[model samples]
Target chain A: MSEFQPKIVAFVCNWCTYAGADLTGTSRIKYSPNVRIVRFPCTGRIDYMLLTKAFASGADGIIVSGCHPNDCHYTSGNFYARRRWIVFKKLCDFMGIDTRRIVFSWVSAAEGSKWADIVNTTNEEIIKLGPYDSYHKLSTQDILE
Target chain B: MEEIKKIARELLAENKVQVVLGFEKGTANKVRPAFFTKAEDIDKLIYNEACIHNIALYLKKDTCQHAKGVAITATPNVVRSILQLSAENQITEEKIHIIGITHEGKCAGILDFKAAEEFSKTQPKGLKPEDKALIEKIQAMSLEERFDYWVEAFSPCIKCYACRASCPMCYCGKCNVETNNPQWIPVASHKYGNVEWHMMRAMHLAGRCINCGECNRSCPVDIPLNILSYMLSDFVLDEFDSEAGLNSVFTSALSAYTVVDKENFIK
Candidate 1:
């Protein structure tokens, strides 16, 4: 049987996780190649709606990583993002979204290995969950007519 | 009902307020929002369990905005919405007078914002048992089952937006959904679009929703929409220990955060 390669999307902050992912590349770290990264100025800039858009656009899994608490380049952007994710994660779970498919983590500029680990772990988890056909079918269906 | 009408009449007769916003019997045994401009029109006022509409939403309307002052019949949730609105600087204490009603069908009399705040303190808060039960039931489902449940529930949405229109907190002049220049949310009633719309609605109202349940009551599809906000409200209470409309002094959960705020889930 063929192996399943899950499609993953990573919404990362430019100041931390993005730089960390960049460091992962420069440091010769091998991680899952399945993830497509989208960089924003800060984690707070990553809207919850955009996360839904990622799923709608066929992403089987999502990784939202940013600076650690009090480490936001914008001072408190990650702190605010943390609170948002806290509520958003609960909301998603309550609405029946496979929140395990969405990973939240802290990947500082120095944590290239941590970034790689998160990617590999999220990729492995998503692969086990298989294709996100339920959401995929929902996003593609024509309900406006 | 007589007490409410008498107060409305006195408010207009004494020139205390230019209008009194309350509810009246609609054509189909339903209670409809009524605006009383004349002292005689106060006779149309009705206060019953069926008069559950949160009339504070009208305070944002242009007609109400231009009025010199307004006297509003406020249920517990309406009082909370008013307090939240006042805290948000949408309304002022002198501009509107509150006519509070108890859950037991009694009048609490004309109250200033201060008195209303005190009155609201005594009112019971949090989700009703039925709502909590439904939330727990959904929470008990498997992820796949939950997804299908919401899909089936939200699929019938026609993008009518009656929920948003009925919501008191959704008073933004230009909602995110209306900004077509960037087209933030899809205008279609499709499944994905509906889910995004509802999620955004709930997120936007997370800490601010007064648990008025108007959004759910107003949905033409019977989509149990209030459960989302109720869940978020409970989260705000448990995680932040903050309740909306409790007093106007505290910052909303999303707007302000402390260093001590709990975020154990983040690595």
Candidate 2:
């Protein structure tokens, strides 16, 4: 049997990681094609539940990237996102969810190479972890459908 | 106990309280939510070990409008829940009266915030082992897996709203799900609608739920509604080290913030 290829969902800020990804494309930097990016106005707008939805949709890994701290377009959106992620991360840890499956990163619009590196590194980590069959097992029947 | 019944009867007879929202025996010796509006109905009020419903949730309903104030049996969790409800403006602090019972079956008096906080301190921590287990099970799932798990858990919901009706915190006259202008959730009973409704309800209760476990117990489909509330409650507790119902002066978790609050992932 062939090994499963993990699906990764990258939720990137429109002003930052999204532009960085565009830069990655413009520069023709080669990286694993595992991630499907979803652009949000800011990381603050990304409800933690969206991460859950991605996993429910069978994504093996999630990357939430936005501007660096104190660099939010909305002055403090990233600050709020950071606080929420702390609690969400603690919750994931307490529940024993594989922490590697979820990554929190800061990628500016100018950081195209950084975006490629993140994708490649996260893809390699998740691929080594194997296909997220445990996710399929955990997702409810209705959500899986 | 007979003493509780006697006091309830006197309160009704003398009109000291307009109503006593206590427990009456169900058809087969079970306990159900009861309203003791008249002296005669006082005899029907029972305070046994099986009395579990919070009854505080009913304080804001139209059915309670006629009453001058409410008097109800209180478990420790009920005290916390009532305080949280009062803090949230679901019910005014003065409109309801409390009749607390000790673990040894002795009745106590109405508690103000000061009294409740003091009383709460005397009572040991309320988080039970089962609460931790339920939370751990939820926390263990990946984000998508958690969503799928909740969708399945809420699949059996028949839109009874027994959970909302039973929750002390769910007293919005125009609930987001019930409103039509900007309907946040559909009013159907399908798995998707039910899951969305429950998820929204849990999120709304985020920091306000006192974990009375009444919603789950009241659900006809036996969905573990407490697990949903506990998931958010655990987050509120661990991150903020804050307890709901402890202070009426402050805002809830999502509503209030600190300048130094964590925001490591925002852009």
lDDT by residue (tens digit), candidate 1, A57-121? 89999999999888999999987888899999989988888888899999999999999999998
Among all candidates shown, the one with the greatest TM-score? 1
Specify the CAPRI tier of model 2.
Answer: incorrect
Note the residue pairs that clash in candidate 1: none
Per-residue lDDT, model 2, residue A53, is 62
Question: Model 2, A98-123: lDDT tens per residue?
Answer: 56789889998889999999998888
Interface RMSD of the predictions, in order shown?
1.3, 5.5
| Model 2 alpha-carbon miss at residue B126, Å | 2.4
lDDT per residue (tens digit) for residues B1-267 in model 1: 788888889989999999899988899889899888999888778889998888899999988999999999998989999999988889988889899998776899998888888988998877889999999999899988888898889989999999999999999998999988766678888888888888899999999999989989888889999999999999889998988897856578998777777766676
Q: What is the C-alpha DockQ of each candidate?
A: 0.67, 0.15
Off by over 4 Å in 2: A1-6, A15-33, A90-99, A109-112, A137-145, B1-18, B65-68, B129-165, B170-206, B219-235, B259-267
What's the distance in Å from true for residue B124, model 1?
A: 2.8
